[model samples]
Target: MFYDVFVFLVIILTLLILSGLVSASEVSLFSLPSETLERFSKSKIRTHKLIAKILEHPQRLLITILISNNFINVGIALLSTLSALRLSYAININPEYAVSISIIVVTVLVLLF
Candidate 1:
């Protein structure tokens, strides 16, 4: 039981770090600081419009990144839960019960946040 809990913690922490890195990379790619822009870079404002134009398709970029990140996070959660159950020999436990409980806890915590 203790070992399973430990493994779950390790996995969760690893996934969180990975997710944070991905988010940071996305933010860096999309972020534009006005102070850092060149004096002659058209319009003089460091707006995302320039980035959007460069991307060729802005909406698709947002959707694809959002969907891909969500899929990865969900996959990580499921894998962590399954790893816990397997470690504890709790194979008979319902996956829905475990996942729903996790989702409920996360939703409540997010609301608090």
Candidate 2:
């Protein structure tokens, strides 16, 4: 039980980190100036080429990022609920309320930072 909870916690943290990175990257990509994008599209560098391709379809890229972020947030909430339930069981508490509280707290923390 302890090992299971530990694994879940680790997965939750990983998801949180991934969520942050994806959100940051989306913001960074959208904030780039049109001149910079044009330069990237005309550059000879391999990385620049790849970035240009990604930015070519701006709407598609934005939709993909938004969807992925939503899924990651949902995963985090589910894992947090599971972890709370496990902890509540170990301490002989009610899991029903714990799950709701944990989900709300996790959502708030994720949004705040």
Candidate 3:
């Protein structure tokens, strides 16, 4: 009942955070100039070196990011719909209004994140 809705909300929030991080990483990774990438390549840090190596093929990186974001977005939509349905059933309200509320809340969360 209420517990299921709460679980959905929690999952939705987590996905929103993940979506934001994925979006940020895409921007940050692509915005790096060649010089910075070169520096990273030469750095002693393994993580930096790996980043430089991965950035060599921009197409693959971009595709992976887009795919992940798309999946997260889909998950968010599915969960939102489920939670909205549960909420409507629990409160005995019109499903349309519950759906509208879910849409608004999801939009705001996406924008904020």
Candidate 4:
């Protein structure tokens, strides 16, 4: 019973840490300026053109970033669920249920969005 409690605590802690990282990244991404985004948007084009593109469609750029971030978050959640299954035995009760519900929600989100 003690070991199970420990595992549950570990799983909850892991989820919290992951959530913090995701939220931080989302906030940082939203905070980035058009010029800063342009630098990375080019991918391979000239910096000047990238800046121009970003300036022209800032909202589109932000939307794209949001979409990408959502996809990444879904991927991370799914991977975490797999990790939980591998690390903990029979992850289908209590804390494991939390992970299961989260996985299902993420899956639904990925499919719906």
The regions of model 2 sitting more than 4 angstroms off are: none
TM-scores for all candidates: the values are: 0.47, 0.92, 0.93, 0.44
Q: Which ten residues in a row have the lowest lDDT in candidate 3?
A: 104-113
Instruction: Encode model 4's per-residue lDDT on 5-113: one tens digit a residue.
Output: 5565466555545555656655665677766666666656676565556557658866765676565665556565655555445544565766686687656644433
Candidate 1 has an lDDT of 0.59
**Candidate 1 lDDT tens digits, 2-78:** 66667776776676666666676567755646443332244545564465354456467667767766765775667
lDDT by residue (3-105, candidate 3, tens digit) is 9999998998899999999999999999999899999999999999999999999999999999999899889989999999998999999999999988898
lDDT comparison, 1 vs 2, better candidate: 2
lDDT of 2: 0.88
- Candidate 1 wrongly placed segments (more than 4 Å): 1-15, 34-56, 90-113
Model 2 TM-score, all chains together: 0.92
Where model 4 places Cα greater than 4 Å from the true spot, the runs are 1-45, 90-113
Backbone atom clashes (below 3 Å) for every candidate: 0, 0, 0, 0
Candidate lDDT scores, in order, read 0.59, 0.88, 0.92, 0.59
Report the C-alpha lDDT of model 2 over 56-80, residue by residue, as the tens digit.
Answer: 9999999999999999988988888
Highest TM-score: give the candidate number. 3
